[model samples]
Target: MVDTALFTIRDERLSLILTRRKDPPFEGLLALPGGFVHAQEDADAEAAVRRVIRGKIGFDAPYLEQLYTFSGAARDPRGWSVSVVYYALVPWPLLEKNTSVELCPADELPALPFDHHQIVAKAVERLRGKATYSSLPAFLLPGEFTMNDLHRIYQQTIGARLDKASFRHKILEQDIIEEIPSRFRTGAHRPAQLYRLSSKTLTAFERKI
Candidate 1:
């Protein structure tokens, strides 16, 4: 079996996606979106995850990464089951207008069915650790955003306050984003220049930010 822990930023908080089970074992209980791997159709664990997410959520995740494998005689009631786990990061805009799954703040999760709570914790830990030195949190924002938007997402994901000047300097020095020429978010104060990711792929920084 394969399971996915989908994450996104909502209302300035890091959030996770959950669905209620409809069948037995844990009927009506909240669980991460997942499904069994099809022997013939799925070429690998990642392929199974993509197929499951597409079928269950009706959209493709922007960023997905393999997390860990969990297996034990008692992890599942069905017995001797092993689960290949994956975590996906989706931009809030991508889910805002498309998905109807329940969104829960990652820090205040209730009891989950199976060992899903452990899976979630592991996923969050990985994301936060990576955010310290990579452009991982940028995947939580829309394609185009201002520096302030980027800053807020990073703070939320990292769960820490950053000095604005230092944060901006670090981000600019990393060269992960490129300013959209002549584009600015105009408001009462000076317009903020808009920028976008240099590439859709994730970039790792040589030094921690």
Candidate 2:
């Protein structure tokens, strides 16, 4: 199985977590965090994903899902190999402060090796769809955040403008989050309510959608 991490824009710049190949084939090229499945290992895809993320990126991912499998005969340069891709959601602030592999932003990324570019593009498309139909974007949010913060994440992930009133209505109607009684006073405007994601509510919301 192949494990991939989808890193989003952090501080106004798009970025993804990748690793430099240490061997032949795609040596020296940056690619998503993943590796081939080893025999006698757990057959669970999620387990394989966690192992790859921790081994390659040096961090444990909290959210992951099976993406797709690429089995084209000529896809792999090492004779023939099938890849079972898995997608991981990572928040910007959760990244490690120091990394050896060049963590270039999306716009400045150099040419990638193999079919990695195609894999990244497909993972992004899947994220956009999940953002619209599920509470997946919540994975990108910090433990606590404001309504505005959530709105901004949604806009960035889905690449669309959302009406303030409509967005608020839908979120509240879904009841997937709880507004913390404490208000954060950041600016001169009225204090906005802080919210915490509710596990029960999130499960219900996904089911409803």
Candidate 3:
């Protein structure tokens, strides 16, 4: 089986997408989006996961990475099974209108079946660890956003407050985002310049924030 732990920042909270199973052995229970790998169609585990996400979520995830493999006889109810897990990040707006799935807080998920909870925990740990020195958290934001928006996302995903000035300088120095020739006005403050990622790829830094 191929499973995905899809994450997003919704209402300033880091949340994950889960769907209810319609069939057994865990019928009517919430679980990560997953399906059995198609032996003839899927070229690789990654491609299998991509097909699963598109079929379930109605869109392709902007950021997807192989997380870990979990295998054991006790993990599944039907004999022994191995699950190749992947973690994905998408902007909230892409999933806000999708009623087929549930968005739950990543840190407070309920007891899940088939070792899914353990998989989610591992994925969260990986995301938080990567956010400290890479542009991984930015995938949670929309295509066009302000520097402040990016800063808040990093803080939320990393689960800590950051020095605003330091973060700004460090991110700017990385040169990963470019000005969008637009501005966003928040209440009485001056319009903040809008920016977009320079490349649709992850950026790793030499030092942690």
Candidate 4:
């Protein structure tokens, strides 16, 4: 199974979690955390991904989904091999800085060894597309955040500016989120209500899809 864990972007940079192979055939080259699926394990793709992440990256992913399968003679140097690619989404704060399993910013990602660049491009496209009609981007935010926080994430994921009033209206109308009783006071501006994801709304959206 091929696992693609997308590190959260912070300070206007996208990060990816990669591991240096300790064995031959692409040894020492940074690649997405993954490995071969064991024959004895569960047949579920998500479970296989969790197993791969635990074995290769030493962490259980918070978010994961099947991306696609790659099966081509030229894709792998090991003769004939079929890879099941999975996408992992990680929040920014969950990542450690300057460490082995740490984040590698998009701007500084060195030349990747295999078809990783293509995999990443596809993952990004999926992320953006999902962000438009789903609450996938909410996974990137902290436990408590402002409307501005939600808006910024939407803007970043979709790469566009959203109308503030319409954004707020649609979000509230859909009942996807609820304001927390507590308010955060930042600077001299009026206190803004902190909001959290609504479980009911999430369930509704999932059923719709």
Off by over 4 Å in 3: 183-187
- Report the CA-based lDDT of candidate 3 relative to the real structure: 0.93
10 residues in a row with least lDDT, candidate 4: 200-209
Error of 2 at 124 (Å): 1.5
lDDT of 3 by residue, 11-87 (tens): 89999999999999889888999998999999999999999999889989999999999999999988999999999
In angstroms, what RMSD does candidate 1 have relative to the true structure?
1.1
Give me the displacement of residue 192 in model 2, in angstroms. Answer: 3.0
* Residue 165 Cα positional deviation in candidate 1, in Å, after optimal superposition: 0.6
Per-prediction TM-score, please?
Answer: 0.96, 0.86, 0.97, 0.83
The C-alpha lDDT values of all candidates are 0.92, 0.72, 0.93, 0.70
Candidate 1, residue 7: Cα displacement in angstroms equals 0.6
Candidate 3 lDDT for residue 123: 96
Instruction: Please report how far candidate 3 places residue 131 from its true position, in Å.
Output: 0.5
Candidates' RMSD to native: 1.1, 2.9, 1.1, 3.3
Off by over 4 Å in 4: 55-59, 105-108, 183-188, 200-209
Clashes (candidate 1): 0
Summed over model 2, clashes come to: 0
What lDDT score goes with residue 90 in model 3?
Answer: 91
Give the per-residue lDDT of model 2 (tens digit) for 58-174. Answer: 777657777888777577687676777887766777675645545666556677776777887887787777778667777777777888888788877776778877787888887
Per-residue alpha-carbon lDDT of model 1 for 1-209, expressed as tens digits? 99999999988999998888889889988899999999999999999999988876788888999999999988889788899999999887777766558889999997798999999999999999999999999998888999999999999999999899999999999999999999999999999999999988999999988
Instruction: Name the better of 2 and 4 by TM-score.
Output: 2
Best by the TM-score measure: 3
